[model samples]
Every structure is written in C-alpha cells, then in structure tokens.
Target: MNFSSKLLENAVAEFARLPGVGQKTALRLVLHLLNQNKQEVEQFSHAITKLRNEIQFCTRCHNISDTSICEICSSHKRDASVICVVEDTRDVMAIENTSQFNGLYHVLGGLISPMDGIGPSDLQVDSLVERLKDGEVREVIFALSATMEGDTTIFYLHKKLKHFNINISTIARGIAFGGELEYVDEITLGRSIVTRVPYENSLTK
Candidate 1:
C-alpha cells in the first residue's frame, strides 16, 4: 500500500511488523496516532522506548521483570516448593489471571520444536534442572499448551527431572489439544490446574 507521506508509511511499516497486525490495521493505527497531539505521540514513543530499555528477565524464572528477579519469584508468600513450568511470560500472565496457582513459575521461553530448529538447548531447561537439584521444589507442574510441541517439551523435561524424586504433573486435558493456555477460558484453565494429572498418565494418551 502507498501512503502520501513517507513518515506515515514508515510508522505503518513498523506497526505491521508486529504479529497479527496487517497493513490496513497498521495504517489505521498510524493514522490514529497522527490525529493525536504531538505530546501524546511523544509520550507513546517514550513509553515503548522505556519498556524495551528497562525491561529485565528474571534470572531465576526467565519471566519479564523490572529487576533481576521478578516480584513473584522473590515473594515470600508464594509456594517455593511448587514450580509451574510454562512456555513463556504470556502463559504466566494467563495462569496468574486465574489466581488459582499460588506457586512460582519457570518460563521455558520456548518449546522444543525441531521443525522450527528449537531444541532443549534453545530453552531455559538447564536452569530449571539446576533449580531442582537442591530438593527444595516438591512438585513440577507442566502448564504448557495442549499442543504437540507442548507435549514434546513436557516429555523432554520429565526425562530430565525424573531422577529428582519430585512429583511431576501436567495440567488436566480440560484444555483442548492444540489449544494455547493463554487463549483457553479462565474457568477451564483454573479447573485444569486445580485437577492436574501425573506426567506418567499424560504419556498414555
């Protein structure tokens, strides 16, 4: 698509680069921002810049944070004995929104998708193993999406952690196969977490 102004074209291009954003939507967003006051636009730009520059990943869980460790990881109130393993920060947000889980999280960053050239080494799997070595965590909950890639990731992790004498479980199949946790209804996701099944049982199906 052609724009009369090069500035408008550039803004639209940048917006379109984001996932799920099309050229038309990008154009609309750029036009909307053009209608806003200069100060408001500057504020928007500054906010994005500040977020990119200041955001830090939690050293322990790999979740996005303002500090080296996230509030959830550092919280004394959270159950340190249980760790819910998820694919990314978005899944963390989804689970947190349900308020059903009081335990901490381990964000793997991404799953084991060999077709996409993502393997165990591509994830934070080694860090998770290190976390389990001390016998502090009693349970590891696989709260990843109910997809094939999710299953592959879970299986690989279970194999790595099996020797630790810790309980290993996965969120109930209340979530549809291929359904992302972030998109599942909160009620279903909450129920799944509350009624999880053993990792061994997950292998049967």
Candidate 2:
C-alpha cells in the first residue's frame, strides 16, 4: 500500500507483523492511533514498551507473570498436589475463567507437533518432570486440545510421568475432536475437568 508519510507506513508495517493482522487492518489501526490525542498515544506506546521490557515468565510453571513466579503457583489456597497441564498461557486463562479447577498449572509452552517440528524437547517437558520428582504432586491433569498434536504431547508426558505414584488423567472428552480448550464453552470445559478419566482409559478408545 502507498502512504503519504514514511512514518505512517512504517507504523502500519510493524502492526501488520502481528498475527492475524493484515496491511489494511494495520493501516486502519495506525490511522486510529494518529487520530488519538498525543497523551493517549504516548500512554499506549509506553504500556506496550513497559510490558515487553518488564514481563517475566514464572520459573516454576513457565506462565507469563509480572514477577519470577506466577500468582497461581504461589497461592496457598490452590491445590499444590494437583497440577493441570496445558499447552500455553491462553489455556490457563480459559480454565481459570471457569473456576472449576483449584490447582496449580504447568504450561507446556506448546504442543508436540511433529509436522511443525515441535517436540518434547522444544517444550517445558524437563521442568515438568523435575517438578514431579519432588513427589509433592499427587495428580496430573491433561487439559490439552483434542487435536492429534495434543494427544501426542499427552502420550509423551504420560510415558515420562507414569513411573511417579500419582494419578494421571485427561479431561473427559466433552470437547469435540480437534477442539481447543481456549475455544470451548466454559460449561463444557468445566464439566470436562470435573469428569476427567485415566490416561490409560482414554488409550483404549
């Protein structure tokens, strides 16, 4: 797209780099920002800058946080012995919104997708195993999407964690095949968590 100002073009280009954003949408966003008052624009820019510079990942669960540890990991009210394993931070937020789970979480960062070249090593698999080694955890709930990649990741995790004397389960299949937790309705997602099944049982189906 042609632009009268190089600065406006550059701003649009940067915005277009974001996922799901096209050049037109980016340009519209840039134009909208240009219409905003100077103070509002500066505040918006400062907030994004500060977020990028100051956000931290929780060392324990790999969740994005303002501090080294996420509030969920440090909360005394949560069930420390029960850990829900999810594909990413978005899944954590989805589950939290349901208020069905009262346990800690271990974000895998990403699912094991062979086609995408994402393997167990590419994820936070080692850290999850290390967390289990201490034996404070007695149950591990798999709250991944119902896609092939999600199943593969859960299978790999189950193999790695089976030796531990803990209950290994997957959220019940209330979610349709290929459905992501982040997209499922809150009632369905919450019911799935409440009615989880053993990993081995799911294998038979």
Candidate 3:
C-alpha cells in the first residue's frame, strides 16, 4: 500500500507487524489514531511505551504484572496448594474468566516444541520445581493446550514432578485434540478443569 507521508507509512508498517494485523487494518488503525486529538494520541503512545518499559513478570508465577508479584499470586483467597500450569499469561486470563478454579497459576513462557527449538530449559520449569520444594503445594494441574507440543511439555513435566508427593493431573479431554485453551468456550474449559484426571490416567487413554 502507498501512503502520502513517510511517517504514516512507517506507522502503518509498525502496526502491521503485530500478530493478526494486515497492512489494510494497520493503515486503518493509523488513520483512526491520526483522527484522534493530540492529547489522546499522546496518551495512547505513552501507555504502550510505559507498558514495554515498566511491565514486570511475577517472581512467583511469571505472569505479567506491574509489581514483582501478580495480584493472583499474592492473593490470600486463591488456593495456594493447587497450582494450575498454563502456557502463558493469555491462558491464565482465559482460565480466570471461567471462575472454575480458585487456585494459583504457574505460567510456562512457552511449551516444549522441539521444532521451534524451545525446551524445558527455555521455559520456567526450574522455578516451578523450586516452588514445589517448599511443600506448600499439593496438586499441580497441567492446563496446557491440546497440541503435540503441549502434550510433550506436560509429559516432560510429569517425569520431573512424579517423584514429588503432590498429585499431578491434566485437564479432561472436553477440549478437542489440537485445541488451545485460550480459544475454548468458558463453560467447556471450566468443566475440563473441574473434571481433570491423573497424569498417569491420561497416559493410558
């Protein structure tokens, strides 16, 4: 697409770099922002800049946060003994929306995808093991997506965690194979969480 101004072209290009955004959508966004007041545009830019500069990952669960610890990790109302393991902050948000779980969460930065060169070392696996060492946790729920990578990650995690006294479980197959937790409906996700089965049980299926 051609833009009359280099500045507008640059802006649209940057916006188009975002996932799922095409050149046309980015151009539309840039035009919309251009239509906004100077103060509003500044505010928009400032918010993005501040987020990139100041956003912190929770020290405990690695969820995105303003402080060292996220509100979910710091909350007394959440079940400290049950930690729901998810792929990222987006999955955490998806699970939270269901209100089916009242537990803490551990966000693995990503799954163990050998094809993508991501392994256990690249994820937050070590910190999770450290969390279990304190003996405060009783159950660890594998809430990863139903993809091959997700299964591989969970299998690796199960091997590392089976020695622990805690119960290891995976969400039920209410979610179809290759389904991502973030894309599933809230009711189905909630039921899956509620009906989670033993990690070993899942292996036999």
For residue 157, give model 3's deviation from the true position in Å: 0.5
Over 1-205, each residue of candidate 1 has an lDDT whose tens digit, in order, gives 7688898889899999999999999999988998999999999999999999888999999999999999999999999999999999999999999888999999999999999999999999999999999989999999998788998999999999999999999876688768998998997889788888788976633
* Prediction 3 TM-score vs. true: 0.83
Give Cα distance to truth, residue 120, candidate 1, Å: 1.1
Worst 10 residues of 3 by lDDT: 196-205
What is the Cα-based lDDT of residue 45 in candidate 2?
96
**1-205, model 3: which lDDT tens digit per residue?**
7679999999999999999999999999999999999999999999999999998999999999988989998998999999999999999999999888999999999999999999899999999999999899999999998889999999999999999999999876687778998999997899788988788866633
Candidate 2: lDDT over CA atoms? 0.93
Clashes of each: 0, 0, 0
Off by over 4 Å in 2: 175-205
Count steric clashes of candidate 2: 0
Cα displacement (Å) at residue 109, model 2: 0.7
Query: Mind giving the per-residue lDDT tens digits that candidate 2 earns over 147-191?
Result: 889989999999999999999998867877789889999977897
> TM-score of each candidate?
0.84, 0.83, 0.83
**How many angstroms is residue 101 displaced in model 1 relative to the true structure, after the best TM-score fit?**
1.1
Local accuracy by lDDT, each model:
0.93, 0.93, 0.93
